[model samples]
Target: MPAQEDSSTRVLEDLDAAAVDYATRIAGASGPARAALRDELTRICLPFAGRMARRYRGRGENLEDLEQVARLGLVKAIDRYDPERGSFTAYAVITISGEIKRHFRDRTWGVHVPRRVQDLSLEVGHASMVLTTELSRTPTPAEIAARLNVSLPAVLEALESAAGYSPSSLNAPAGGDGAAEFGDLLGGTDSDLEMVDDKLTVAGLLLRLPARERRMLAMRFYGNRTQAEIATELGISQMHVSRLLSRSLAWLREAMLNDTLPRWEGANGPTDPHGMQIAVQSGGGVVTVQVRGEVDRDTAERLRTVVRHAVSSLAGRGLVIDLAAVPLVDAAGVAVLLDAASAAAVAEAELTLTGAQPYVARILGVSGLQSLMR
Candidate 1:
């Protein structure tokens, strides 16, 4: 593909001269004229996402998949864009970034990112969101640890995964009475009728989730048990259950964001994205959880499912994340903490981690997540 150097360097106004030609081609949308213009437009927007893509290149398991994500953003910008909305380059850049973020979020739920990893990442995001929502500002890493009852380092580690990421809120509308908002945290999952059928509904999306995530969702959402109760039922510690639930909610969130699932002829299945992760959770009323042992990638998925479930089910008003036996956590382990943090935010629970190691604190400080706690 030929590069549009002007779109890469020159201003949008200057690019307008070229835009006019493409506009005609897009408007034409019929023949060779349209083909040439579409190709040209793609050429122009592709490079805008290069810088952001660089950050996740080797970091992301699939580089080709990442570029496709970037391409998806570029196309969306060209399609919905107006030449008048400032520089086309700037517009493309924003669209590209949005696309990349969306990919990360989706990947966090659906694929290249394991369901467990995404769940943990979601927790960190949720914690940050909770701080911002409750205090109307960014809370420091210390506050998060204080809230979860964990040590300063654990909180920092959780925050680290969310360094360049921001948390997203469910657009659940305000009720008519506008009653106590936090009190409403005691409600059930707000699944729509769309999830009832065998296609785009919650059940269908559940198929995409990993087996552990699927089972937890069932016991929690369909069983109607508290987090602690579920923990007893599953024979896992209450904290383990809590962490799993929290991760589950994050996956459900990602799945919910995927409103459309393609259905094949005679096959009611959605084609999984090239790279993805889908967060989903909701069930029960209140929960208390307990966790032990050092967390790593191998065990991270279990942790994520637990945390997400805890949050989505509104298991309790507060969460106590006990890290007493956890001696060391790698980068992947930190990701799991983030997962629980994100869920706790939505469930309106105070998440605290207890007995963090000095080594953990050093990791958190190096990651620059200390600022998220108050």
Candidate 2:
């Protein structure tokens, strides 16, 4: 066994030596010689695929998707690498992270969890953030447990879950306000600016959510599913889905809505306003308002304003309020929505709700809108 193992190691060493030689030659040459580097890059990046994939084990994202994203990042790093500046590890780290961030910004999750659990996830994240900042470094689970007053196992669990979580995406363009955008988080590189917009960071928000709620949010948003469909798929009552949605939306609003500029926002400005999308202006019937946090009565009031603004121009078009993407909302949302629909009707427009969710649907049904919807 020892002889065989040594021989296998020597064979690997010989292959590595030949690969490096080929890569170094390709790096110095132009044109077709660059082709030689491709195989070497594929070989070098094979190991990184697992490491990055491991980082994403707990989040509800698909392993295949994670591996694909990581692989693309690795390839990109190899292609764009410049030996003039730094080590391969540093470059690869940035590359893999950048790719992951893009996925976080653009992709939705594959599973759902509960609202209380979602909020707990957020609290755990906050605790980690506070502990990291206060300690000026990453803290052990025991240390985190001490600070959070939770069990060490809980702290470990949070860390493990968060390991798969992508940091908030910074996809806004440079300088709507010139510095309040999330693109600033990656140090305002023109290259990074082209990635997904920070405003689209629904993925990171989902990770902060409780596991079950996160799963539900994934199915609803990414799946573009109707409440009834979601209910049937999850084997739960539509009313239950609606309720879970309401709670989760409130949590999402809390995670996504911001008053002060986030650290990343200092360099990248806000995205093109909601009205800039051709979909919004061409009467496509979509409205995106930046509701600050916690979709309770107050946020619901704000949402009413958004709904009014969205429908003000369409005037009798099918009114589809998109709540499929939010992380939280509450019981008050039903009243606000019903009121908005009434207000829209008063303006002589019909409101055809598309994403009423199970809980929200039940609330409306129980509140006497079932016959109206039918």
Q: lDDT scores for all predictions?
A: 0.59, 0.59
Residue 11 error, candidate 2, Å: 15
lDDT of 2 at 114: 38
**Top TM-score model:** 1
The TM-score of candidate 1 is 0.29
TM-score of model number 2: 0.28
lDDT of 2 by residue, 1-374 (tens): 99999985665465445445555788588776677568665775676665776675545568888888988898887777665665666677778876865665446422233333333454566566678889999777787677767787765665555533454446665566766666655643476565455545766655555444566777898788888998777665676578677767865666566743233211011232221111233346433333322344334556666677776766556565544333334566667767877876777766655444564566567776665442
lDDT of 1 by residue, 1-374 (tens): 13576554454554555555566558748787676777787786555555556655644347777788888887787777675665566677788767776677765432244434444455555566678889998888777666656677655654554543432333443466655354456568767654556345566667765555467678888878787877666556666666666755665666666766432111112243211222332324335455444454445676677777666656465555555455445566677777677767766776665555676666655755453322
Reference-based TM-score of each model: 0.29, 0.28
lDDT of 2: 0.59
